[model samples]
Target: MADSPEDTIAAIATPPGFGGVGVVRISGPNTAALARAILGRLPAPRHATYAPFLGEQGETLDDGIALFFPGPRSYTGEDTLELQGHGGPVVLDLLLSRCLALGCRAARPGEFTERAFLNGRLDLAQAEAVADLIEAGSAQAARSARRALEGALSHEVNALLDALTGLRVSVEAALDFPDEDVDILREAQVQARLADLSGRIDRLIRGAAQGALLREGLRLVIAGRPNAGKSSLLNRLVRREAAIVTHIPGTTRDVLRETVSLDGLPLHLVDTAGLRESDDPVEQEGIRRAWAEIEAADAVLLVVDDALGEGEEEAAIRARLPGHLPVICVHNKIDLTGRVPGKQGGVLYLSAQDGQGVDSLREHLKAQAGFSGGEGLFLARRRHLDALTRTAGHVATARDALAVGAGPELVAEDLRLAQETLGEITGRFSSDDLLGRIFSTFCIGK
Candidate 1:
């Protein structure tokens, strides 16, 4: 494959596994040339043609559908070609080799998506949402990613930028006419607008926080005294005999983790060694690792035996957990204890064996993560949060500068800085290196 910047990029467009249909995608100025070389004729632009895909030696590799999308309106804004063929690894490899032989280079990870963002076919945030949508772990997460891909998040960012641009233009006009001696006090009006914008950005940041939570999900550690049915609860939650549940104390000597979704919120649930003094070295090491997990978790599930009561046992365990780590106290074996399975404050009573009260606990967990079980939620990344934080900080600085009557020129600098920070979220102010890092994480042929 040539290293020329204008060389066409090609890749298998489906998952690396057997399927009913597999697709090879190509995009660049050389798309039509490759299509002619491989398919024996140029594919009709924006149309599908059934044909026998061929190699350079005119060997029939697989008969498939060829589709073409001319530059400007297509994804990546470049001449594009797609070959849908039988989903076999051998067939895909041969077809890919043929494309390479015809002067089409293999695409890098996320190259297609990167090109799309670079060509203005999609904003940076929306481009990221495409990958998020593919990797979504829950229906809620997928819906959120779809909303973001549809421009819900980018629309808000663009609206904020437009307002900031207007304010910047006004300040620049005042700067151009220094002889007018524009009273800095009059800039209060602009400062007020910046403050309002900052408030809105705050709201968006909070919403994005919830979106990120739904995307990254919660890491929950189950820790409590020995014989609290922690293992049983884990098995029940995961709906399998994943752990060895026994009556003997200190039975679980290691940590067990499983990824589970509760009411559409993904969570990494960890069943750790019960937290208590132990004579065995293995149990001690497990306790140490359990604490480490508890510290790192986004939330903790303190499992307590309802039949045994939760007074001093629960207190000792709570004292060991890191402050600020959210905990949900579970009174397991509620059926045996005759306590109704329900949630009160931060405590949830449930019989792990019978599967009672699991629904209420799942609902509570989702509510804690800001999931309302609706389609309005949209996926967001940590990068967006950082940009919003920076933007909010700049907007605040500009407001302070105006309130003190420092100068319209100074306030204007803050406003411009805020705009740049906000622009980075959607690549309006992004550098090539940042763009490279973001797109390189995506699967090929995005």
Candidate 2:
């Protein structure tokens, strides 16, 4: 949709369902007029007043609390109104219809937050955090999203940008005045400043990577021969019978996915069919799909029967795993082997049937994700990580350029590019298409 602050927008702010209360939101220059037409009078700014919501013929459609927020101080940085009434779908629709009849257009998804970003009330990162907070799956994810909404990530990015700007100014100044007796770059310690900036960016990259992990979680695939306790491991990790546990080979002929929270980190576990050559078309197809899942997974859990031990078949499975993907070899059924449940030779030894050594596997997954709980973490998206990574690359290039006695012009350009790249996270250098793609994912009435 077009960015039109002049046009009034209204929507059912609450989710589409029956609840104790639902909110119909309105914002624009016409908010005052709409309030007068619907509420009979504009309620005091930021104050909730109980009133009857009027219809076209001045009929009382519903009675609820009306709240008015004048321009520049509201969520959208414009005149905003909210109607809190009974949450029946019909009632909410009636209230929304009244607003529409009085000159308010229906709000598109994320229009409210989009307006907030455009009106300078929140940066892009904070606007995205608003949605992240709503979609957070765990307490730690919620806390991280809250921190980001409160400008934790933005503060760090802005500080880095400011420092980079200052360094760029020094480098450019040296370029402008070549005949000066004083080497401005040397005097200002440009090299040291660049080095320091690079170090800070590196740290930020690491933190953002962790935050990204918290946001996106990990897609782990459990792959092995049939009846190797892969399904048992899946059910054990999720603490439920998510997959069928049968002694028959190839009992699991398809991929089954379940999500579990490991101390706040979301683990998307996929139990795939056993990987073994079979003449049956259905079994062959399952094996093909299993390999497909393995190719797309972030990590693989290669479960093997400890009683059977690692044979040539297990070695072949390990050999087929993607080299870049992290693979955790799980030696299950330790109970059958009369061995203690623990980790040995970096391979997890566990009995999935009786829940032995599962806790260790949980810790291993968390550690592999680099997630240390919510403590001081900020929620981040893949785009944020990508921007930071590109910024780091540019900064490193500039540092190398400076070290190699490169001209001030070349160093200044690289620093400028680095600053611009960093600005993408905060919308300073973002494109319209980027904003559209980012905000479109948010639910309506946000």
Candidate 3:
């Protein structure tokens, strides 16, 4: 992701397919010269003008619009040019080759946006949202990513930074006058302010957590005995026949996985082989993989056949659950049992064949994952969440110090660490390794 100080980068911006038009994006100090060589003349800054892109041997590569954006006010904060031409891959390649022949290097993935970050046009969180919005699987995910792209998350972080800075000022002031008669640490106003800041930090942490869930979604694994309606329930939820359903036990001896969005949160639902001891080597290996999935899954869904009653099969299923996992026990085949489908003690009774009580099951899954949101939440990445968690831990340590009547020196040290941790979120305090990782995830034409 490193860029030379003087190298100009170019790339075909449109997706690789036939289309009405494609874009050749270029950025660097030499963009104007490349534009002039390809278009025969430089178009007005930030204006589109029709031009014929010429190639070697004076052949017309393509005719399209030429747009130029001078440096420091463009997407990458550098002189940039956009050449729009026919969507044919060959035509786009000819235009790109023409630009390269005139001294422009092909852009690496995420090089465009990385330059934007380095130029101070956007922060780390906002830059990531650009990628998230492009790859969002649902309308809700796209909307949330747009909010982060608009700086919603950065604004909140900045607000927290300001609060932390003010508190540091007060704490240091108190430390300066150690012998004063008035107890600065014990003052009612000071305690009230500190409590308010802590509460706000908690609220921000909760919001970021929800945003992270929306971005990455939750992983759910369905495990149960044979003939327990696991495949039936999966097919019913996806509203299609993605898995083969049979009355025979042990029909599904391999893992079947699907991605579905339920109520705005993406769900990676996996249907595993029935958890039973089998002499068949394939089935035994499948059962082992099922337990591995259960260990890493955010939630485990246990399916039970209600008509069959809780016999040895059901007992085996219950015994397989890992310690401290959120389990959604499902009692399938409720329609045949003549009982209404509902939840009782974290278990839901339903009929997967008839699609009965699936709505309630989806809601339960979301609630268990803490996804009580659709809009108004900013998209967040794992790195951003880690920073928030680290900063919050420091705040918690400072609160504990306050409770024990610790000296201002200890409290100030904790606050300083918290401030630096938060600063890393916005690149105010970050290592080059972190920057490289963040920008490497983006595409070349971003």
Model 1 Cα lDDT, one tens digit per residue, 172-235:
7777776444645447567677778988999899888878877777778888778888887777
Per-residue lDDT of model 2, residues 1-446, tens digit only = 56476899999999898999999999999999999999888899999899999989989999999999998999999999999999999999999988888878999889999999999999999999998888887788889999999998899999999999999888877877785466743744988888889899889888888888888788898878778998778878777423222111123433466666777777877776545679999878867776676687789898999888778877777788888888888999988888777788889989999988888888888888777875999999999999999999998898888777788888999999999999999999999899989888888898
Q: Which of 2 and 3 is the better model by lDDT?
A: 2
Give per-candidate clash totals.
2, 0, 2
TM-score for each of the candidates: 0.86, 0.89, 0.87
Candidate 3 error regions (>4 Å) = 177-179, 182-190, 240-255, 274-294, 314-321, 403-405
Scored by TM-score, the top model is 2
Name the lDDT value of residue 5 in candidate 1: 48
Arrange candidates by TM-score, descending. 2, 3, 1
What is the TM-score of candidate 3? 0.87
* lDDT by candidate, in order shown: 0.82, 0.85, 0.82
RMSD of each: 5.8, 5.2, 5.3
